[model samples]
Every structure is written in C-alpha cells, then in structure tokens.
Target: MSALETVRIREAGATLAAEAARFSGYGWMRGTSGNLSLVLDRDPLVLAVTASGLDKSELTDTDIVLIDGDGVSIDGDDPRPPSAEAGLHAHIAARTGAGAVFHVHAFDAVIAGHRWPGGIELRDMEMLKGIGHSAHDETVWIPVIENDQDMTVEADHFDRVYVPATAEVPEVPVLIVANHGMYAWGADAAEARRHLEIAEWLVRFTVATR
Candidate 1:
C-alpha cells in the first residue's frame, strides 16, 4: 500500500477505537462481544476492523486489522486476526453500501429480538425519525434473523432477509440477531453510531412498555 493509503488505514483504526470505547462505556460492548468496521475503499471493498478478543474500552488505535470484502486479513504485519464477526460486517457493508458497520451486544436488542423473532415494528414515536422514519403515522420494522455460530451461515441468513431501500421508503439501517445482538450501519461512522443508539432506544422503549 502507498503512504497515503497506510495513513488512511491508521486514521480509520483510530476512529474505530474511539467508537468502541464509546459503546463499551454504554455497556453495550462489554468484554470482547462486539465489533466495528470502517470501509476504506469501496471498489474492492477494503475495511479497517477491530482486532479479535480485545477489550473494547481499552483498545488503542493500533488494535485494528485490515480486511477485504471477504473478511480475509490483508495486513500481514498485523499479527492480530480480525474480529470473528468481521465477515458479517463485510456482508452488511457490501449489501447495503454502508461505509461503517457496528455490532453491539445491547441487552435491549437481545430482548427485542427474542420477543419478536419475526421483527420489531416501531411506529408513532418521535424517535422513529432518528432512524430515517417519519416521526408519526409511519412504521419501521427492524429485521431479525436467527443466530448461527458459523459466520458464513449467518451471512447467508442476513442475505435472505435483506431489504433494499426504495424511493418511497427509507432504508432501515439496523438488524438484530435473535438472542444475540444488533448491527447498525450508515454512510459513515457518526451516522452509524446514531442509528445504533436510536435503534437501541426504540427497542428499549418497546421492551419496557410491552
């Protein structure tokens, strides 16, 4: 890689570390239970993903690995392997054209998924606007897929339920894995984080009230 590309990767790593720390503080990414990725290049789909088995809150900017669209590590110098969920991240980005993907084991997400295995529908709430839905008189369904230990199988399940955004409907940038966690994404890191937070809040509210 060229010097500029190397610099970009390092920058993305720092961003990922900061995001991880923030989510960890929220108690959504406790232990090494979550992962985040940033798309570095779109054509061939290069990503900077958090390294596996590291404490999210304690991660440094260097605690990241480069991976391809297939989630295969490209940075040979980095001894760490990508997060086990990196392939799911890659699949989400590839399918949705998202620039950043975040997976967190939020308690509410797990509860919501288990309670509504088919999906969770949120409507008539002002917070719904936060996830690109109308604040009132509109509904959004957060997709949920069964969990699998094999990443490839998980990716396949994701593909089966994936929905393309349309002019009439905004894309729901979040997904929940039954009894597992949530995945959220956006065109960039900030938006991805926003989507995750808003989705979690919506789910929490749903779980609390009903």
Candidate 2:
C-alpha cells in the first residue's frame, strides 16, 4: 500500500473507532461483541474492520485491521485479528454496495427479534419516515434470522433472507439475528451509523410500548 493510502485508512479508522465508542457508551456494544467496518477502497476491496475481542468502549485506530475482499487480514505485521463477522460484512458490502456496515448486540434488538421471530413490522410510527418511508401508513419490516455459531452458516441464512434493494425490499438497512443482535449498513460510515441508531431506537420504542 502507498503511504498516502495508509494515511487515509488510518484516518477513517480513527473516525469509525469514535463512532463505535459512542455506541458502546449507549450500552449497545458492551464488551467486545459488536463489530464495525468501513470500505476503504473498492477496486482492490480493502476494508478496515474492528479487531476481534477489542473493547468497543476503548477502541482505537490500531484496533482496526485491514482486510481484503475475502475477509483475510492483509495488514502487514498487525497481530490483531479481524472481527469474526468480517465475512458477514463482506457479504453485505458485495450484495448491497454498502460502504460501511455495523453489527450491534443490543437488548432491544434481541428482545424484539425474539418477540417477532417472523419479523418486526413497525407501522404508524413517526420514525418510519426516518427509515425512508414516505408516509405514516407505510410499514417497515426488519427480518429476523436465526443466529448460528458458524459465520458461514449465518451468512448463508442472511443471503436467503436478504433481497437486494429493489422496489420490493425498499432499501431496508437493518436486520436482526434472533436473540443475537442487529446488522445495519449504508452508503458510508455516517449513514450506516444513522441507520443503526434509528433501527435500534425504533425497536426499543416498539418493545417499550408493547
């Protein structure tokens, strides 16, 4: 990698680290459970993913590892391992053209997923507009898939449920892994964070009022 490219990635890592830390402060990513990733370059498919088992509350640029499209760590001499969900991130990016992806282990997400294993359908909520629906009558469905210990198995399940954004899918930015957590993505880091924040909040509100 060129020196300039390395600098750019480090900068992006610093910014993403801060975002992850803020989510951790919100009790969403307590400990080292959740993972965050940003696509650094598309042609070469370089991504900066959170290092495995690193406390999100204390995330730093160095806690990010550079990986290739295949989710293999390509960061030279960086002993840190990429997040176990790295492959999942790659799949989302490839399928959705997302520049960033976030996975969070939040209480509301787990609760909602269990309560609505078929899927969580939010309707008549003002926040529905924030998720891209044009009107109040529209319903937003967040699919809940069963979680698996094997990342490959989880990815396969996600592929089955995840339909690429078409008229039917309506650009749904988040999904839940039953009793596990939520996955959100967007065109970039900020958008991904916004989607995640909005999705999680919507679930919390739904669960509280029920």
Candidate 3:
C-alpha cells in the first residue's frame, strides 16, 4: 500500500477506537466480549482488528492490530494477540466485501436471539432504513445462528448459513449468535455502526413490546 493509504488506514483505526470506547460506555462491550474490525486493503487484504482481552473503554489505535487476510498479525512488535473471533471477521470481509464488521455482546441481541432461535424480523420501523431498507414496511430478517466455542466450528456454521448478497436476495448484513450477541457489517465503519445500533434498538424494541 502507498504511504498515503497507510496513513488513511491509521486515521480510520483511530476513529474506530473512539467508536469502540463509546460502545463500551453503553455497556455493549462489557466483559470484553466484543470486537470490531476495518478493512485496510483488498489486493493484499489487510485488516485493522481489535486485540483480545483488552478493555474497550481504554481502546486506542495501539489496541487495533493490523493483520493479513489469514488473520496473522502484521503489525511489528505488537505483542497482543488478535481477537479469537478474527477468523469470523476475515470470513465476512472475504465473502461479503464488507469494509467494516462489528460484533458486540449486547443484552438485547442475546435476549432476542434466545427468544427467536429462527431470527428477528424487524419491520414497520423507521430504523429499518438505517440498515439499507428503503421503506419502513420492508422487513429486515436478521438470522440467529447457534453459537459454538470452537472457532473453526463457529466459522463452518457461519459459512454454511451465510448467503451471499445478490439482486434477488435482500442483503442480510447483520446476524445474531444464539444466546451470544450480534454481528453487523457494512461498506464502512460508519455504515456498520448504523446497522449495529439499529439492529440492537429493534431487538430491544421487539423484546420490550412482547
């Protein structure tokens, strides 16, 4: 990558760190159970991924490790290990061409996923537009897949369930890991944030109304 591109990626990572801190403040990332990542390059396939076991409330650019397509840390002398869920992030980035991915352990997502093992169908809400729905009446079906402790197994389950976006299928960029949390992605960090926030809100709304 060019020097300019590298600089831009660093700046973007810093911005994402701030967003992580905000999410932490909201208790979405409590217990250090959440992670976020951004794509830095496609040709060589570099990513800025969060390190494992770090407090998001104190997240900084240093907390974001640069990794390759295979989730190998490329950032020199960065002692921290990449998040264990880094494989999932790489899979999503490769399959969906998403520029950013956010996985959070929020109460609403966990509760909703448990309540509806099938999925959550959010419709007739203005927040749907935030997740790429053009009309409020359009349904946003977010899948809730069973969770697994083994990363390889979790990834295989994800691969088996995830359907690539197409003209015929409405993009389902957000999913819940049953009894776990939510994974939301978009073209960039900002868009991913919108999707995550909207999905969380809708999940909470659904649970509250029920």
Candidate 4:
C-alpha cells in the first residue's frame, strides 16, 4: 500500500472518515446515524467533518468539509453539508484542544444509557489509561445527558455542564447522550478513535457483567 492507500483506509481519506469507517465496522454507526470530525490545527483550530447524513461506510475525502472556529464551512462546495452536530465538534475542539471527536451509536452503550440514571461510572478498568490520566484508584465519570432535537442547545448544554464536569478529570474523555449515542475525543484522531473504542468496550463489558 502506498502512502495514499494506507492513509485512505478502505474508503476513507480524512481522519474523521477513517475513524467513522472503523466505528461503522464495529456496528457503532449504522444506517447513516452517527457523525465524526477532526481538527486541522490547534493554535487556531479548524475542522473538516463528514457531510451530514452520508452513510459512514461510503465516506471518502470528497465528503469531508472544513469549518471555521464558529463552525461555519470554509471549504469546497459539496452539496450534502456538514453533520447536524458540527457545532458540538467545533465547541469541543475550540475549548479543549481536541484534535478529533468521534460520535457513534453503539448497542451496549445505548443499553447502558438506560441502566445508569445519571452517568456511567467506569472504575478500576486498566484500559482507562488509553484516554489521558492514569487513574486505577478512582471512578471515571462519563456523563449521560438526554438527547434533544436542538443541536445547538444540546451543544451548549454539553459546553456548560458536560464539558466542565468531565474536564474535572482528564481520564474521562467520553460523554454519552442518553438513548442516542456516545462521543469520544483526544489530542488527535488516532487517540480519539482509541477513546471511542475503549469506551465502547467498557460499556459492553459493564452491560454483559450486569
């Protein structure tokens, strides 16, 4: 595989598309439901996200759309458009220096959403180190907020409550939208995808044990 072939895994180009494809294979993003994004820069962050509602499996570089600090597109004209949750990605990248954010609808995660009243607590899991902190002695709180139709409102809620609450601990790099899906991020796309995968595994393990 050449550099291009390796970079474009399966049918992906942008890091977001690659992660989306991986998550789709894991059955987290099905039926064109979930979305993903990655930041281009950090000193002055900019984003290139998948065009909204496109099937994650068929994603290619052509579908990746760039957005400014305000979450407005600053790239080519692909008629489809960015995901409805683009603002949420922009918010996290701007505020937290996150290079990538992966959102998905995993089966076990959805089940765990109903199981936990507030948020799911991931404690004593060795995989917790993949995120950021090395906390084998504490509970990593992954907040689960109710999903809503208003993307901007939900984004604000995430910023105001969810972001602050989770940022209190570095290891907790995930946020669950009750009954909807999950979001995970990191300094870059690879790490972010790892975070998503780890969170998915932890949730699945918790559900199976219970």
Lowest lDDT sum, 10 consecutive residues, model 1, at: 74-83
Over 98-119, each residue of candidate 3 has an lDDT whose tens digit, in order, gives 9998999989899998999988
User: What is the Cα-based lDDT of residue 62 in candidate 3?
Assistant: 64
Best by lDDT: 1
Q: Sorted on TM-score, highest at the top, how do the candidates line up?
A: 1, 2, 3, 4
TM-score of each: 0.97, 0.94, 0.90, 0.84
Q: Mind sharing the TM-score for model 4?
A: 0.84
Which lDDT values do the candidates have, in the order given? 0.93, 0.86, 0.83, 0.75
Show where candidate 3 strays beyond 4 Å: 1-6, 134-137
For candidate 4, write residues 1-210 as lDDT tens digits.
377633543233455666778888888889688888877655566777787878897787767776777667765554557788887888877766777888899988888888994888778888777766554887777777778777677777677545443555654678888888888888777788888888888888888987
lDDT of 1 by residue, 74-134 (tens): 8777788899988999989999999999999999999999999999999999998888999
Better structure of 1 and 4 per lDDT: 1
Higher lDDT: candidate 1 or 2? 1
Report, for all candidates in order, the number of backbone clashes.
Answer: 0, 0, 0, 0
Candidate 2 per-residue lDDT over residues 9-127, each given as its tens digit: 88878987998989999999999889999998888787889999888999877679888887889867888889988988887887788999999998999999999999988888777
Residue 196, candidate 4: C-alpha displacement in angstroms: 0.7
Determine which window of 10 residues in candidate 3 has minimal summed lDDT.
Answer: 131-140
